[model samples]
Target: MIVVERTFTVTATPGAVLGYLQDFANAQEWDPSARRTSRVGSGPIAPGAHWRHIRKMWGVTTELTYTLIAAEPDRLIFHGRSESATCTDLVVLHPVPGGTEVTYRMELELHGLAQLATPLLRGEFEKLATGGVTAVTAALDDLSRPAGLRRRLGAATPNRLPTPAEETGI
Candidate 1:
C-alpha cells in the first residue's frame, strides 16, 4: 500500500470546501491524472453517490468506480476500485480564522502482481499527489472569490409571478 497526504488552507468556508469536494466528478478539475469523471446517478450528492473515473498515469489508462463511503460536516471518505487496485481517499476540513484548513489523503493498494511494483511507483505517485494538491488549492481559491454581478444577482433574486405583459402576448 502507498499513501500520500497533504494539508493546506484556503480562504473558503469549511462548508463551501466540503460542498465542492463532495461531488466526486469535480476530481477531474483538480486531479492531473484524471481524464474524465462523471457521476453514475444524479439526485443529490450523498454517501451513496458514485462516480466513474478514467485516469491515465504513465501512459496507461485505468477506469475506476468511486463511491462516497462516508460524509460528515467536516470530513468525507471515498472508496474507489479498479481491476488492479483499490483506492481510499479521505478529506478533512477545519474552520480557521479566515478560511478553512483541508487535509487530503489517498491510499492505494495494489492487487496480485501489481503489488510488486509499489515501491518503484512511489516517487511518481508522490509527484502526482503534489500536482493534485496545487490544483485543488487553486480551485478552492477560485471558489472563494466573489461571483460576477450577474451571477450574484441571479442567485439573490427570488422567483416571482411573470409581469402582466407576459400573461398576454401583445
Candidate 2:
C-alpha cells in the first residue's frame, strides 16, 4: 500500500471549494492521470453517487469505478476499485482566514497478481500520484489567482486540455 496526502489553501470560499470538489468529474480538469472522468450514476451529489475514470499511469491506461462512500459539509470519502487495485480518497475542507484549506489523502493497495508486482511499481505509482496532485494544486491556484495576475503565469498548456476525440474515446 502507498499513502500520500497534501494540504493547500485556495482563495475560494469553503462553500465554493466544497461544491467544486464534490463533482468527481472535475478530475478531468485538474488531474493529469485522469484522462477522463464522467458521472456514471447521478441524481444528486451524495453518498452512493458514482463516477468512472479512465486514468493513465506509467504509460498504461485503465478504468476505475469510484463511488462516494461518505459525504458531509466539510468532508468526503470515495472508494475506487479497478481489477487489480483499490484506492480510497479522503478530502477534508475547512474555512480559513482568507479562503479554504483543502486536505486530500489517497491510499492505494494492490490485489491479486498485482500484489506481487508492488515493489516494481511503487516508484511509478508515487510519481504519478504526486504529479496528479501537483496538477490539481496548480489548477486550484490558477483559479484562485486574481485575474490580472493570472496572465503573468505565462502561456497555457496546450496538451493539458484533451481534444474532442480523446474526450469521447475515454
RMSD (Å) of each candidate, 1 decimal: 10.8, 5.0
What lDDT score belongs to each candidate, Candidate 1 first? 0.84, 0.77
- Local accuracy of candidate 2 as per-residue lDDT tens digits, 24-109: 87778767677767787438878898887788877779888889899888998999999999999999998999888899998989
TM-score of 1: 0.86
lDDT of 1 by residue, 59-167 (tens): 8898888999999999999999988999999999999998999999999998988899899878888999899888888878777887751122111211222333664
The TM-score that candidate 2 achieves is 0.78
TM-score of each: 0.86, 0.78
> Deviation in angstroms for 66 in model 1?
0.3
Residue 55's lDDT in candidate 1: 88
